[model samples]
Target: MDENSIAGAAREFGGKVQGAAGTVAGNDETRAEGKRDEVGGATETRVGQASDTVRDVAGEAGDLADRAIDTGRDVLPEAGAAPRRGGDTLTQYAKEFPLAFAAMAGALGYLLAVAIRRRR
Candidate 1:
């Protein structure tokens, strides 16, 4: 987006110079060039505005996610009521279904391997 804006600005600047030169020289071609530059400048302004809007929206989304996480943590009960170790979570899940967990782990490992290979 920034690249697009920069290109548009450059185009507008060039047009201005051409238009000014054309006006002084009394050339129709020069006047056309100047008008073209003005159009390019307007395009750059629009693109820059759009880029800013996207950034602001993305920032708001991140803030919302953080607030949701904090609210969820506040809702959960304290460990003093019943302390469940890290392994307890895995044990309970595995007891429910051991094969499913193994397959999930295998799939994750395969995905990681593929990603690493692609990077290389």
Candidate 2:
């Protein structure tokens, strides 16, 4: 995992230990601080996990784009061959990379909706 995840895990463990110690010593303030730390650490760890997920999705999208470009190049007309239709090309891509295609289509739809709303 990322640095935030590692640090958060460590902090969470420390907080648990501190909380237990505070409970044994009957210190309410220390116990509260430990609990707060535990919450903060858990939040940080979740943020780190989300960040990693975003990074992975972005990488996948990039790879998909690159592959699409390569496929387009390979499909280019040679020896007077007829050009492929846009719909067919898109259908091919959607079948080959369903998730990436869906993600891109959703993003495109969202952007279009936002643009249309802005015009109104």
Candidate 3:
């Protein structure tokens, strides 16, 4: 797919041919060199393949992140309003029943303290 992959494949094929030629001519040194080229070519091809895979995964992650941002933009306003309305309701309740709200808040704080102490 990539230049390295193509070049490595070509190199490997050349090595195979060279190795065969050496065998026919009975040159051990030439055969050894050809075998070395073959291994180097195969390593280069694997490096190219790994590079391609990393590029693809990075592209996919970028696309996924873009989609997530778009979705968040579409949903945020409605999500934001819920908490505002809940806060308004709590304010109304506290105004109408100060003592009850205080008692409830104290009880919640006590429970949180107990939970923290148990963790420690």
Candidate 4:
């Protein structure tokens, strides 16, 4: 239990004791105060329980997000390996067609430069 829960329990026990003592002494005011304490203690205990429930829900959400990311990585490892395979294909094509590859590379560089300049 949290601090609020512990304090609430303590108050509840103390109230019971005070009420018993008040009853023995025939003190109406003391008995009334004891009853009020009992009600306050119950409210505090509910507050503590609510707080614990919220924390548990937030923790479960974080765990689910972590599991989703791990599953994505395991299911699509090829996404991470794609760049190496693409590079190998490009190298093979360039060896077979040097002049075509040079023209394509020059066009690609010009397009990249244009795009970068537009962004600024």
Q: Each model's number of backbone clashes?
A: 0, 0, 0, 0
Which parts of model 3 are misplaced by more than 4 Å?
78-120
TM-score of each: 0.53, 0.63, 0.62, 0.60
Q: lDDT of model 2 at residue 115?
A: 100
Better of 2 and 4 by TM-score: 2
**Prediction 1 global C-alpha lDDT:** 0.82
Give the per-residue lDDT of model 2 (tens digit) for 1-120.
Answer: 778998888888888888888999999989888888888888889989998999999999999999987887788635234344666898999999999999999999999999999999
Off by over 4 Å in 2: 77-120
Per-residue lDDT of candidate 4, residues 29-101 (tens digit): 8888887888888788778888888888899999999998889889996787799999999999999999999
TM-score of model 4 relative to the true fold? 0.60
Candidate 1 lDDT, tens digit per residue, 1-120?
A: 566677777787888888888999999977996888779786886797788788889999999999987887788746433456666887888889989999988999999999999999
Residue 80 CA error for candidate 3 (Å)?
9.6
Query: TM-score: which candidate is best?
Result: 2
Where is the poorest 10-residue window by lDDT in model 3? 73-82
lDDT of 2 at 18: 82
Candidate 1: residue 110 lDDT (0-100): 100
Which portions of model 1 miss their true places by more than 4 Å?
A: 77-120
